[model samples]
Target: MYCFMSTIDPGPPPQLIQLILSYLKDGQSTTEFDLRVMPLAQDGSTRRYFRVYSTNKDSFIAVDAHKTGGDPKTLSAPNQNQTFHYLACHLLERGFPVPRILQHSSDFNFYLLCDLGEVTLCSKVLENGHKNKKSTLELYQKALDLLFKLQTEALINFEHSWCYAGSVYDRNLILENELNYFLKAFVKGYLKLTVSPKSESRLQAEFQSLADEALLAPGDFFLYRDFQSKNLMLKDKMLYLIDFQGARSGPFYYDLASLLNDPYTQLLQTQREQLLSYYYKQLCNRYPKSAPDNDTFTFFFHLYSLVRTLQTLGAFAFLTRQGRKHFQSYMAPALENFHHYLARLSSSLKLDTLVELSHRLYEQNLNVKKRSP
Candidate 1:
């Protein structure tokens, strides 16, 4: 027999709750009002979310992005609330399906957004048992279409300061931030293994080469740094994007890689290929001059996929180490995807040591699970 216990977390402070209620009231008078606050499931980020329910059953999401030590701005560049508000408002104005910012505190630390219900594309994929390829492909196609709009239509007169990372996704950011993140978070932290000086040099060189190659692609489009099924919400069959505060200017391949290589969805190889072809065709049709040749685009797709996979593994390792148990479930899948990318790369890249280390980490995780009982 299994016993389950539920502990309800009393959301934000009473004063904060009242302030949010007043904002929702928007100068309207109600004889009797009741409000219920429920904490939502936490994600890898430091942001806290609560669903606010009123007597009329109207709902909105309250975000308490108070000054957490590890706020994204500390690592990225812009204020979390500011980036979210700017990007949300920008996308919403352009007819993109993002949550509307209903209200925000004067200081911009807290805000209310349209409640986009609980079903994410990731949840929908899981509900279908990840076997309904047809349905899954349709959802992905819709997501890709929306992404096209973000890259093109949303780029018109975009402000760089609005992005958390103000600069375009450049080689240095890729090498210093992303590649180093993988080394520190996954290689050293998670696997408890150290890279030899020679291996480290080799890894850095390879990363630099890959980043340079990826930069050869166009750099004018918006890159959704974490575009995946988890960030996509489905309401009434319309897909909405959330958690886009990390958006920046970069090659289009980055977002494509993120969506296709997303471990949460674990899209099959054939499905990914078909989707890639679909996206390429759509890009050519829509922006003929901007789209790169199929070969060049595919090359960057693979490279960006590797980068995204490594960054994701780094995040999983870092989060788990930080005592975020919710991230632990993603470790094995992330490792699997990491291996998938490593296998696809050429042996001449000299990533054999990294590949071996990843396999050892995967095996070690399995051993730990076996011993847990």
Candidate 2:
């Protein structure tokens, strides 16, 4: 069972809550009363969210984003709340569906924002109980359409004011950092598997090739790093972006893999392909100059999908080991997606060599577990 979270009476402690009430009063006179705090979901991140109920009126979301929540110094650069504010302002101005920023306190590391209420894309799909094929495909197409619109109209001239914001998302960084997650935690710590010097050299060579494909990607649009179903909420037939702390100027395919092949809500293979084609058609309608043909987009799609799958494997392992979370449910599905790439690339000498070494490590770990008292 999941751990029980604490409740806040009336609202969060006086100072911040008081400030929120003050801001609400300044904007509009509503019902004339104090705000009440109600705890909401605190995911694996350091941030905690709350629903603020006004006396006999509607409720708004109060984001208490202290650096000390779980990850230390979260308010430092690339903080979730700060990125949300930046994207919210930018997207909303361009007529995209996003939550209205009521007010923000950078010093306190909290924000009083217009609540989106409780209806994420994942919840809506699950609430339907049975996975209706038609509905799922339609929903994904809708999501893809929004993404296409954002990439074309809104993200074209996106400027990076902050220092870290302008930095290119190197593929080497993605592979090197995420590879450490599985190598250090799962293989070394949990499974107690050691890599020989020869194996390490072969693994590095395979990763170098994969990173080349990922890094060669064009930095076209503003990539919302975690643009999965969990971070997407539906409101009035539109998708709203959330949890955009890691937003960066990166490849077009980054957000594409995040949405279509998300472990949280698995879209069928047919649906995934259909949605990709739909996005390609819609996106090409705008930029006819550098539009990719059918075959070219397919190649890029598969390559990005492979990169995303590897990144997710490492991320889920980190969450399970370090965060003490149950992410085994996601492991199999992620591996299934990863296996597609492995099957195609099996003929490659470096890939085959690395897979052989990795399988040996897995076998050794299983044997160690069996022999343990």
> Considering every candidate listed, which one attains the maximal TM-score?
1
Off by over 4 Å in 2: 1-15, 27-34, 68-80, 106-108, 163-166, 189-192, 287-289, 346-350, 357-373
Instruction: State the C-alpha lDDT per candidate.
Output: 0.78, 0.67
lDDT of 1 at 44: 79
Could you say which candidate leads in lDDT? 1
Off by over 4 Å in 1: 1-7, 68-78, 347-373
Error of 2 at 368 (Å): 16
Report the C-alpha displacement of residue 215, candidate 2, in angstroms.
2.3
lDDT of 2 at 95: 86
Clashing residue pairs, candidate 2?
none
- Ten contiguous residues minimizing lDDT sum, candidate 1: 364-373
Against the true structure, what is every candidate's RMSD?
4.5, 5.0
Q: On residues 110-174, what C-alpha lDDT tens digit does candidate 2 reach at each position?
A: 77777777888887766654358777777778778777666556665455643234345676566
CA shift of 60, model 2, Å: 0.8
lDDT of 1 at 178: 79
